[model samples]
Target: MQDLLDKIVAEANVTPEQAAKTLDVIKEYIVEKFPMLGGAVENLLGGNN
Candidate 1:
């Protein structure tokens, strides 16, 4: 998770908080669109499954 956040921060020129929020939005979108993959995504992305 930290690795991804660091990449996003560096590539997007965004702050840590912004990168985190972007990840949250992406997580929510994925879970909403593909409910069955929610657990997998959470596990991979460091969230409560």
Candidate 2:
């Protein structure tokens, strides 16, 4: 997750905090819409931490 945040910050030129918030929103939506794939999505996002 940290790595992704960092990459977003670097590549997208966004702050780390912004990156985290963005990911959190997307993750929440995905989990809500696809409950069964939540675990898999989390893994792809880095992990279920």
Which predicted model would earn the best lDDT? 1
> Residue 11, candidate 1: how far off, in angstroms?
0.3
- Per-residue CA lDDT of candidate 1, range 1-49, in tens? 8999999999999999999999999999999999999999989997832
Give candidate 2's TM-score: 0.74
Global lDDT of model 2:
0.83
Give lDDT: candidate 1, residue 19.
93
Q: lDDT per residue, candidate 2, 1-49, as tens digits?
A: 7888899899999988888888888888899998998888778885533
Q: What's the lDDT for residue 10 in model 1? A: 100
